[model samples]
Target: MFAPILMSSGVSIQLQAVDYLILAVYFAFVIGIGFALQRHTRTSDEFFLSGRSLPGWVTGLAFISANLGAQELIGMAASGAQYGIMTAHFYWVGAIPAMVFLGVFMMPMYYGSKARSVPEYLKLRFDERTRAFNSYSFAIMTISSSGISMHVLADLINRLIGWDYTLCLVVTSVIILLYVLKGGLTSAMYTEVLQFFMIVFGIAPLAWIALRDIGGWDGLVAKLTVTKPDALHSWAGTSGTENAMGVEWYGILIGLGFVLSFGYWCTNFAEVQRAMVAKDMGAARRTPIIGAIPKMLFPAVVILPGLVAFALTGDGQGYELPTKDGVPNYNQVLPSMLLHYFPSGMLGLALTALMASFMSGTAANVTAFNTVWTYDIYQSTIGRGKDDAHLLRMGKYATVFGILASMAFAFVAAQYNNILSILQLIFGFVNAPLFATFLLGMFTRRSSSRGAFTGLIIGTFAALLYHGFSHAVENPLGMKGGWLAQLLGQPAAFTLGTELAQTFWLATVAFSVTFLVNLIVSLVTGRDKTDAELSGLVYSLTPKPIETHEPFLLRPAVLGSLVLVVAIFLNWYFW
Candidate 1:
């Protein structure tokens, strides 16, 4: 079923039986972690946050593992095939700044305030409505994202077992749910160490194969330079008319790179939950930067395979490949590549790589989602008087519910088969406003609950509208003689559908309008909450805090500044 991609230029895939056995053992190992860790589960906090017991390095590595999803290995590289280094702006511009900002500014406040969930912080800073709005919206987004994860994971597994893709999703989701249901973060974090290594091991062989195919690093670069010059050279993509709302291509840079970056890193509950669950102030403070080290190199591992495939395509060797309806299905490229290049034992290993991503992502969500529900929803709302066991039970129930719903959604998503589009739609509706509300809540004490809720509804609708109109415009462009079709022509086609920038813009506009609305409502209602009243929740910078105002000489603040400068230099030099 999945053999075509392995038949690369000349390499022969080997190891038919042993590889699959090792792969089965790998799955058994992860499941065993879940059951083994089950004995330690006692309370919601222990289950959901690994008892806040992880060291800085463990949490840091786990954090990186969680963030680098299965799609990232393929998706970003797929983007690189088309957009070059520009897509990495999601990392460079968005990720680096967010890491620094979190370390210097956000982490201190979150950890110091001792808030359990980011929305709990919001409630402290704003109002109950703010908490409720953010919580519900975040829950929906995360669950839907889980569905996509299920689809990808299921597809990867199906490639090996010849099972129905939707069935694969259901099985994988059930396994994750059991572990998550049993021990939550303990299972996730402890097992993340295993899943993380599996991914690296799987990629190791493929990278070797890629280099071998091109005859070594120098030869690969030289051949690639001639064939995919633009793919390697520029950090920026060309701008032209016929983008969404007639906006130029430059909008992608501004919207996806800048606006969306702030939202996801600063506000998203899935990522923020990690910081909240950190073992101590030190771990919370250092884990993100620790994670960033591997993350910086992640693109080289995750994206290079697709680039290899893209390179192969240009060489007259790949013309036979289908393009998922001619839209350059980056998601499928990894599977296709695996089928073509991996030897038998290596094939099991490559399949495991995909499992690593799927498991890591879903596990991260299961833990994070449970945290939000426990601290934000259940503790504060339903089952408020429940005992620790009850809360722990509820969290497990939440994990089950989360997985079951996502499996159903995954099945639906597979039938539709538009992972990126569904992802943008889901995030566009959820992320932009959450980003706006959180930023406002963090920076402005005057921000009211009314403001946050108002912002939430407004931001969500704006994204929907943006997606709606953008889709409308895109339909004509997909036609034979539309502006986009004519301009981009064949192969290097500027897909109107997946331009991430347009989605970001839609979210941004919605965010801006809703933010303005929140401000006006706050001002008009004049229901004020002073910073003094909210001190414990909002502005609780460390008692031993290094003054953000007075620049530190040898401080983390100083190191952060140094890092940003170096990142900027790298981008420019490489751009």
Candidate 2:
């Protein structure tokens, strides 16, 4: 049988002096960039959006890096081990299309309108109430999400190095605070580009070593066919629960591929904010397209490690999930793989890459929250008529607050059994409703502020109800066992599994309800927005801008098409 992951197994690898040297060099270089850019971040716009002067390459790398948080690093690998290769769909299906759509269609309105933040765009298109609702909720979500990443970092360190979790949290938080306070978003983006390169170099070696040890892709597949038959197939048997992932084709296609995917890539400010900082319209539009290229291929590095682990551990090959008090800890797959495969020096680089992932994600959220708070909430309402310098001061202060608040949330996440489930529910509640509101506001001129706000409220309520229904069956929680069951006309035994499948369906239901409600309310309210008000904000009233100086290869149409073609091929090849 395979050994458990605890250090008691005597399998833990030790780091060499050279490994610590590499980590020291990386930290020095990253922090050095922050100090170098401190001069340029004197103004609010430069502090928050890099003075809107970043090249497509820099913004594009950072755009994807910001989203590759603890969840992407740890969760994707764990999913690959547990749910098999189908987890790759999160990239090829759930990300590529929406990214392409954003680049080719949505960037025109978002970048051309010159809105400093996503909530600002809502204010321009809708009303004050709409903007406030989005701004406040988004701020809270970003801080909470950032804290969870900090917690993940601490937990990983505790597992791998036997360090105190509290110490790990403090060390990581201080590093993030130092760079963000000095350089703002400008420093964050530059460092994110550097992290992106480091992450590839760090993980790619593990993947190569693992594949070689297992003989190769075909050999790994042959082994999995015996140990984990369903793990090798992506879409072959996804129509029902016969596959490793219990989701159906409709669930994958409509629930995930459409609702969840579009909701995240299109509406989430963390990713969109990177594109917003581009030097020009062409650069902004090309950001996601450039991101999509690397994004489509990253599964090979992150996801493959999980598969390698599963194959190696299963049927008594090597290391296995650690059992703490008789329950298996599956989340340690990636770290455990590094310990098993890499030696002393290389292990430090891999761990540093992991640290970079969490830090990049946390910084992105902090910067985004600060921007929204400084511009949308504080400036628009309380600090009206403030000078740019005054607003810049407020933004820096908000960044500090954001980092502190996130650290607090990281402690709170430790109280939960499965923090990712809570995060997913938050996404369902926020992104689904928010996307529905944005969709109606952008595509149609008739959507009223009152109607959009109503849809948002109803959509959120619908998501909560669905999540309650799904969980009530598995674990009874007061009303979910009694009142909620009666309301749904189903018994507590009718519970659904609270996985990606449930989250996707809940988001889908919320989107549908919000879209219908918005449509009905807008039609009844009649056209409230004049063409002048809708200029570059609404689809029909906006005229396409000419960008003839741009090369044909870099055009949104060409890049988006290439992205789609590659996505299609990946899905088919895996099928």
Candidate 3:
């Protein structure tokens, strides 16, 4: 009778024109900063790379903003609602090591190269087809991802502020795009610092209140264990194949580390834009890790309150799952939890934090997409004939275009309920070959142009087919079949066929086959290109200065490993 998220549960925090006015004003200020920075962005270099003058914190904050898209803010909480501590490993175990790897080995190569774009570097080392192929493929993913981002901010705002959902989406998106178009990356970076602070300040109190509401640490744990032991630690306690709790170790190592990290952090143009804008090589070098350090702790800060909500709502349950809306949806963990636990005025603040979390992602994506279209697709392609003045005008226009694209995507993305799952579907096809092609291009001088080109084409296509085919298997009847079907797994979740099947298996198959296919092609083609030519392409970028000592890597590595070990111990202990 008492659903935690029922319509009548709390006083509706009806939004006023003043609310929209305040948000609009903030949007104007962000856009004003961008327009003011146009003077600094006179050349293609400045427009694309912030003229390469950003400092450690500037680039570092933007780097964090780039990765902290709406999918992450909402998805982390969603995963927690279902999975538990095992969910946190996505960052602590997966992203941190990838960050450390980037700082020690990859960052040097990236900054050292002097290449404008990732694909440009590929072209230099391999072939034009490789460069063009990567450029376009990445562009599509970034746009789709960015557009979906707008909906996230809009969705959270609507839920938090109690406004018409469409109105919230429109108002939030229009404001964000205005600033993004105005100053481009400059405004985006500055705002990210404020956004990050806002998110932390907003979320911290709610978490404290939840813990206090349960009485204390002991009370909180005791209450949660009694209410939902499945959410307590392992998140790995799924009874059988349909279990959301049962993430395997092999999947963790590959799914997150090799595929996701390299895909998001390393190859993403949005992420690369952060490094490219850095003031110097030194700033660029350390900023990624500096940025990464806080992100590792994010799940703890963001997901804790949701667990508390589950603890409070149990038995016949206050709110089972969001069945009122649809099937097995997990996106409600934050909004539903906040509404139940936080008081009135504080609810507004919590709402702002969720909006800020989303805006950070929206603003970051808008800035990067503006840079990409202006630099890669538009300036390099369609508007190639224009002068500097014309190109600059066109560049600002590109931001507007990107904003519209994102708005469109947000509307369409509603059909799919799981934001993270949809994103992973896209990543399945593109992320692996992206990691492999770039890695080989940098480290191995023996790799050939034909090999690199063929590898990318073969790998990406294979991954796409793997995803489509696997999904087909997942629902031979169709995906509409709900949790009962999922548990029974008509097609199963992880396997082609089994006690279970997951989306991960196809990704793994795609990754292995593509890599092997590309590797063989590279070797066969290596004979045509002399070793010197290969090495030249590989080392064409200015080499980063090496210090044999890296005391920093040890701590993250140790910390990351400790988290993994403890996770396995807990899963085993609980089982």
TM-score of each: 0.86, 0.95, 0.84
Model 2, residue 550: displacement in angstroms?
Answer: 1.7
lDDT by residue (41-121, candidate 2, tens digit) is 898888998999999989999989998886798888888888788989899998999999988888889998999999999
- Sort the predicted structures by TM-score, highest score first: 2, 1, 3
Name the best candidate (by TM-score): 2
Steric clash pairs (candidate 2): 46-51, 473-495
Error of 3 at 241 (Å): 5.8
Local error of candidate 2 at residue 57 (angstroms): 1.0
Q: How much does each candidate deviate from the true structure in C-alpha RMSD?
A: 5.5, 2.7, 5.0
Candidate 1, which segments miss by more than 4 Å at Cα?
1-15, 159-161, 215-228, 236-253, 314-329, 472-498, 539-555
- Best candidate, lDDT-wise? 2
lDDT of 3 by residue, 177-207 (tens): 6666555567677778767766776677767
TM-score of 3: 0.84
Candidate 2 Cα errors over 4 Å, as ranges: 1-5, 8-13, 319-328, 472-494
